[model samples]
Target: MSEIKDIAKFHIFSSAYFASAVNKNQYVTDGRKEIAFIGRSNVGKSSLINSLCGRRKLAYVSREPGKTRTINYYAIQSRRTVDEVEQRQDWYLVDLPGYGFAKTSQENKDNWSAFIDEYMRKSPGLTMIGLLVDLRHPGLPIDKKAYDWLKTVAPDLLIIGTKGDKLSRNELHKNLAQLKKLFPTNHAPIAYSSLT
Candidate 1:
């Protein structure tokens, strides 16, 4: 765990909250590259953002799903040293509102779906879409639908299996195999555990 933390701490020179938007006009459009994280309401999107940013509290995480109602953006930069000079790649990590929350009214659901669709279609800086799913239960019908739609909008799509540590090694292996069959990816989905 410490090793993972150490790597995250050292690799990212800067990772900070940048923007949050409920409307299209509010989105950040500074021409920075963006990699959006998306999934169901309970798929651990916030946790993965925190882990990836090396800050435990970077993104508000809740046991209850659907707490994030807005599209949140985090600006991040990774530094590297080459030939005694420094190089940095600046990017934004966009955390989209999770879908499949049944508590919301149909109107709210429709609005969110429309908003998300608009963002994906219009964001010129969006480079890739990272879709997360629970390793314990991969390829639910909802997830499959999301992936299918994402593939059309995103030139590059990455599928990650979260909560990997919750599964036994054998179970993880089996689930990963299942994930391979469910998604159209050249590689198998990588199982991720925030704690690891």
Candidate 2:
């Protein structure tokens, strides 16, 4: 769907911070599915997370960009229905450090790149990668690069256009269409407004 998921159809019943990993050894080893979020710095990764969990302060919302350095994991038990049966599915929501344009030293950025790459390449629990792009800036080279790389790694993907509320409905459609040209998918990207 090119809109936010229906709160009723796919909703988080319980979500709590599970672990923060700076390396593979520290990662949660339980066999639980993981869904990850990645995007540019100050792109609202934490805010979107809090919004998805329906909790205002679940994740720290920082004014400074790239405040998240480690891979933080949250345990989630969500409600869903497969066929005719309604069931609870447990998984991990992984928040990766944001890439591109943040107030950090070049050495630190390089370290982060290596660290994030290791997790993305090694995490067996990764079920899907959710790529968030700014709805207004559809042509950012960094975002397109991330999209291309992520699709090669994870077949299951969700592309989201953030800050939908900033644009008019007509403008949102126009922007989403442009984003399609760069990040192609079977379905149009979701215009996501965490505020809504």
Per-prediction TM-score to the true structure, in the order listed: 0.91, 0.89
Q: How does each model score on lDDT?
A: 0.85, 0.82
Q: 99-183, model 1: which lDDT tens digit per residue?
A: 9999989999999999999999998888778889999989699999999899888757778899999999999999998988899
What is the per-residue lDDT of model 2 for residues 1-120, given as tens digits with 9 covering 90 to 100? 322233336668899998899988987768988888999987888989999898888888898888888999988888888798898778889999999965678999899888887787
lDDT value for candidate 2?
0.82
**For model 1, what is the error of residue 61's alpha carbon versus the real structure, in angstroms, after optimal superposition?**
0.3
Model 2 pairs whose backbones collide = none
